[model samples]
Target: MQRKFLDYFLFDKKDNGMLETLYREDETSFPPFDTQEVSFYLTPEKRLSLKYPAGEKQELSYQGFRDNITFILESPFAEYFEILGSPYLDLEVRTGAEDLDLFIYRRAIDENGKTVVLKGNHGEPMDSFTRGCFRLSHRDEVAKDFDKVRVICQPPTPKSGVVPGQIYRVIASAHTGLNMFARLGHV
Candidate 1:
């Protein structure tokens, strides 16, 4: 999905201070889990569908940006947040400008398996025709095991019939944290 910070937040087992999953960039200001607001998702219209601190779900619109480009969205410091990382290029983020310290996304899983799509760009923006999106595969079909699933790169080859870089955040029902040990396939 089109995320501002959900994708890049560092996933540290010892210290990934994540909160509930919120949609609208403004949700960072919403309630927390202990104080509580849970996870969030994007609607087809790009609105953020999330849980409120009172334990209710709410759909929100993008608050957009200020003249400085900083998000109007922000939250109080969270007790804990579970940031997700993909199998492809699990980068470490030491700093972030998005002020979401509360409301973390509780991992998601679909009929497919444990999955996630925080954010990605396979190639440079200008040369996007050769860019690719992350792809998913499972080691087993029926069990849909988290330990057996992986997010692989769609090779940046001109011959691959799929549209280059067209896919964005499509990973669903993510299991928290990246299984960095997964045996990834083609890049």
Candidate 2:
């Protein structure tokens, strides 16, 4: 019973991807569909709060981070549409640092459009904040006909450079989530 349609923001990969969306009028979101992917930093004091693992491993430098954010919904003439539970992502990941963990992927397009993509990898032990929140899924085998959720918080890119990629921050509003509990997050 969740049919209220029309929720925008089809593409946005802030700074780290260099300003990809601000809802351009009739401009069709101008040549900025996240500039071919490069993100890990969404402003408001670059958010990510849920820590307790400074076990010892330091060497940070995520040049202009810009973690992703793509929430686009436009399907409501039924025939098929189902997503129960909330879409949440106020995240936290510190899988022993050094290429931490958390990378979510999902893209759907049905109703005759045909499209699906699902990839999830959260480094085990997932992390604190009481295992913080990171539950965002529409899996009926990728929502079977259309239901896309795009929340990109890096980490898990090793093979050509053993370690360096994990900065999933998001707290600059919500009163910085009570001065940053970083919220019980997910994507």
Say which candidate scores most in TM-score: 1
Model 1: per-residue Cα lDDT over 22-74, one tens digit each = 23322352232233323443333333335223444333323324321111112
Per lDDT, the best of the predicted structures is 2
Each candidate structure's count of clashing pairs: 27, 17
Q: Candidate 2 on 88-152: residue-level lDDT in tens?
A: 34333323344433343333443454442222121122222111223122112222222243422
Give model 1's TM-score versus the native structure: 0.21
* Alpha carbon deviation, residue 148, candidate 2 (Å): 27
Global Cα lDDT for candidate 1: 0.27
